[model samples]
Structure formats: C-alpha cells, structure tokens
Target: MKNIYELVTMFHDVHPFVPSLSQFAECVVAYIGVFVIKSVFKHLVCLECLESLYSYLTDIRNYSLIARKSNDGLLFPAKDVI
Candidate 1:
C-alpha cells in the first residue's frame, strides 16, 4: 500500500513487512548501550579501533569514487548503484 520511498516510521508496524525489524532495533540499541558503557568503563577503549570500524567498509562504500576505482575485490558494485 506504500510507495517504494515511503516508509513505516513506527516501531510496531515494521514487522508486517520484515518480521525481525523490531528485534533488530532492540539489538542495535543494546549494542550502542554496550559500546557507550564499555567506553566509560574502560579507558574509552581504543579510539583507533572505533575510528577504523567507522570506515570499516571504507573500500566497500559505494559513494566513494575510490571505492569504485579500487574495489573490484569487494562483492557489491562500487558504482552504478541504481
């Protein structure tokens, strides 16, 4: 009943289309809490580890031209997303 760009923004309705969406949100929040708590509990862990993970898919992100030129090794197409 919705267009391709239209989205169900509510937490409850997502399950009709993808059954695990609600649970997936819960898991993400839980992981974010752990990431925050671990940063506070320890010495903020390794900043580089988080930074590198921020670009964890550096070579895999499609928006990067460098990814397109250099990422034939990655599984997804680097350019021509459409």
Candidate 2:
C-alpha cells in the first residue's frame, strides 16, 4: 500500500486544495472544449473542482483516522468508514 502520509503531503501541495479565484477561472476556461458546454461551463468547472477538493479532503481525513486508530493498537471498524 502507498504511504498515507505521502499521499496526504502530495495532495496538500496541489493547486486545487487551496484554489484562488483566478485558478478557478482558469479551470473553467480549460474545461470549456465544446460549444454546447460553453454557457454553463464555468459553473460546472467550479463545482467539479470543489467536488474533487472535497473528495480528497475526505479521503485524507478517513486515512488519518484509520492510521491513528491502528497506531493506537485499536481496530478501525469498517462501518465507521465512508
């Protein structure tokens, strides 16, 4: 398995984790490939970026929780994971 800390560190340094408005605007422009998606593309891109950020944060949180429990010699129940 990959080192959880390494994964967390990598993601911590990534852009979307703490995005600026210009970065958000850039992402919107980057994802606007087709004419059909042009009108709502900015909103879609913003939402997608936020969703990705949320997903990554949740994964890190879950991994840290599991790691803490394991390090304390306790079992992390499957039911507690999302």
Best candidate per TM-score, number? Answer: 1
Clashing pairs in 2: none
Provide the TM-score for each candidate, comma-separated: 0.25, 0.20
Runs in model 1 lying further than 4 Å from the true structure: 1-21, 43-82
lDDT of 2 by residue, 1-82 (tens): 7699999999888877655456445333322312223333455657654333222222333335334334544322221122
* lDDT, residue 40, candidate 1: 46
Q: CA lDDT, every prediction? A: 0.40, 0.40
Candidate 1: count of backbone clashes, pairs at least 3 residues apart or interchain: 0
Off by over 4 Å in 2: 17-82
Error of 2 at 55 (Å): 25
